[model samples]
Target: MPVSPLLVVTRLLRCLSIGLLLPCVPTGALAQQLASPRDTSFTVHSAYVKAKKQHPDISIARPPVPRGVRAQTKLTYCTPGSRALQLDVFYPKAKRRQQFPAVLLIHGGGWRSGDRSQHVPLAQQLAGRGFVAVTAEYRLSTEAPYPAAVQDLKAAIRWMRANARTYAIDTTRVAVWGFSAGGQLAALIGSTNGNSLFEAGSCHRPHSSAVQAIVDVDGILAFLHPESGEGNDSKSTSAATYWFGSNKLTRPDLWQQASALSYVGAGTPPMLFINSGVDRMHAGRDDMMRQLTALGIYTEVHSFPEAPHPFPLFNPWFQPTLEYTVNFLNKVFPRR
Candidate 1:
């Protein structure tokens, strides 16, 4: 028997609803649409809010150790309060007597959540590539705000330098790489090397917090820029507001002070920026790049097409991101 016209139309509609009729639509298109970088900052903020509601005591599991890498956990880097700030260090088994370069890996969580354990895989990957990798925990906005996180990161750098010999790290070749909010701190540390204001109080005194190179992965460069999408309006509370405890209207000076752009100058370290092409979170990136170029500082930028802000944390993009990072570090801090 011949099929009725109405029945044929209904079958087509059902196939279309399930996407079976749309052969041209790429596989994983829905996931790509959901993970688009266009509004990733807000997406991340929402996730944090939801996680806080659902699981107040959420714990991050440490990643499994990779082959030929050594893991050291919970080493105290600073004692800011009753709580001690600790870091996890990873390094490769030395093939020879040569010292390895070091990298301080910073995790991203909108400056409110997340911990050092989030970066364990990246740290292990770097360690496997013959670098001493340290992932350090910093105070979140929930505990302390604004410069507290920055100071803690700088302290980590100093602490690492002070104990460089113990890990067989080449002191002169130290670098920092931060993801998301950590990217902002990494840029801040690189820009404010000689500035005493950001130097955390006496954690590892007399040791320089200067880094020879910096790698920023989807980090905001200027928090107040119009393109930042941070809503600078008086009543609007941005992630920056949460970090600073005040809106731009109320604390314009502090907003400007905390910006990485504010610290850019002649001596800024060579930097490599890995960005998400569709991500607007790292607004004003071009402006900073121009300034770096004009000042004759070495800088490079690589954007992943249609990827999310945290693309580097996952596979397919992860390998390429790691390659770009290692290559940039090698070029900036070449083995002598």
Candidate 2:
């Protein structure tokens, strides 16, 4: 019997897999060859740029609900305009009768784009882990500006508390988790609990906006830091400028006032800071951590070396990121 050409090729591939008649390269050497310094640099630069432009589109379909979880979509939390500001709620169907800790998940788009749907997968995962997780929508820079997004987030927290019994959520055990610009809002919400300046919304006003814990995923801590890579140049229309409606030179006070670090004090909640080690977007994270430490607040910081800014949203990094987040929340807002 004669072998077909396809069979011969398959046999060659099998042999190659076993290192037969092939040069055996060291793992380190092979990695080096596949990713030279120059190539790696370019790849990193490209990834950063791509991540910057990536935002959750309203049209993307939501992921299938996990087997043990139930999702409630588009529940109004606030009404700022013609459209109601809504949130998608996720909770374990099996544990729906029992009270659970709640987490508010905020999506990131430099406060210019992105919607609540971006965090549906995360909310679903948290629900599967026995949490009443909510992914919320807020006014963007396109609709409003600066404090408006923060106001919406704070209002969402208050809404959670206002409807705690309805959602089977433990009012005392709640946290806020956000990515990129959303992270900045989460951090600010965590720090400015009783502060009136940022708490401008009318929804759920009687209820407190405080969170028991905070999870900041690569959010800007201090906008003024040199390492921020968000230059202070007044002429450029950076995201910060767009969000603030002015440059640092023109609105230095607003820039400082908007920073999460500026509000960190005795009442600041425990925080977990996760970052791509190389991202300048999280430039002032260390400073914020130090301030929190000095104030005797519990703080944890984790960085994934050589990862991109949007690392947590994708796989490989997402698994570990989820693990870190769940573990931190479990410790901070433990179920009794």
Candidate 3:
């Protein structure tokens, strides 16, 4: 019996997400090896079903889109030659004359899986609450590696600013929100506001990629910090190792550079950290808060004790997570 290339890639992604490492494959060669039908198994529904094993009462059902909020899906935000990155937007239908603060939401699946639709419910709720919320898609580790996803996000931000009128977005109060791996990305992107290393492509180059605020949900701040649990590739390849294209020991420089804590300093914007009971999930958060506090940059944190890492997508903690996020965003980007 012969194995299908798509099945092989899907299994590889699942292994990587679970911290099992595989041999490094060159990007060009891997691109040529893969066939049609990309894997899309990771989603809020799947996560909820798995989480229900521990929390039997949790729910994944999202509320109805509130009245006056509009949703537009499958909007192309960027074209990186090989692929078209799409995003889903949710914003108020009325009050086109007034520009509202916007937030770009990024989902997480160990950087190997997950897609924009995982955060669509949250975006819809945010829109109902008077925000221009967007859920964006980026190249996963299976498709591309580090800096590629980051670049895609920065491009998405620029796209928002470039089409501010179409979405009724207030460019000055734009924010980036991420869950898990996405949270790590949000922090890094926010920390490196004008740094050119992560900023690439010419899409909406005139519009800045800098975000006014960052919301990190259970995402690590430092990859190689003493408190960090990532890059344990002694026996198996960790997801971080696969995404970075090198183990922490082999490429310490890249790991450190990718850490948000490395660049968080004077210019970093205000931030909010939402976490589950898993301390290892948010490595270096305390150190980051201390630095932000010293710099007089507003910082807030909320932890769901004993909750799973994907608490935001499940009930019992979902409402509170949404509340904290809304409060933090409103406080940082006050409504005019």
Candidate order by TM-score, decreasing, is: 3, 2, 1
lDDT of 2 by residue, 114-187 (tens): 66766777788889888999999887765566788999889998999998887788889999999988898898
RMSD of each: 16.7, 18.7, 4.5
As a TM-score, model 1 comes out at: 0.79
In TM-score terms, candidate 2 sits at 0.79
Per-residue accuracy of model 1 over 1-336 as CA lDDT, tens digit each: 444557556765665444232232222433233222322342334544554553454322234566889988999999886559999999987756679999999988878776776678788888988899999999876556678899999899999999887788888888999988888888888888878898767689789898889898988888778778664544544567667765566567777887788877888889999987645667767888899999999999998866656666654567778889999998888886
Off by over 4 Å in 2: 1-65, 94-97, 231-236
Over the stretch 210-282, how does candidate 3's per-residue lDDT look in tens digits? 9999999999999988888998877876778868876776668888999999997889999999999999999
Span of 10 residues, lowest total lDDT, candidate 3: 19-28
| Candidate number achieving the greatest TM-score relative to the actual structure | 3
Best-fitting candidate, measured by lDDT? 3
State the displacement of the C-alpha of residue 155, model 3, in Å, after optimal TM-score superposition.
0.1
lDDT of 1: 0.77
Steric clash pairs (candidate 1): none
Residue 24, candidate 2: Cα error in Å is: 66
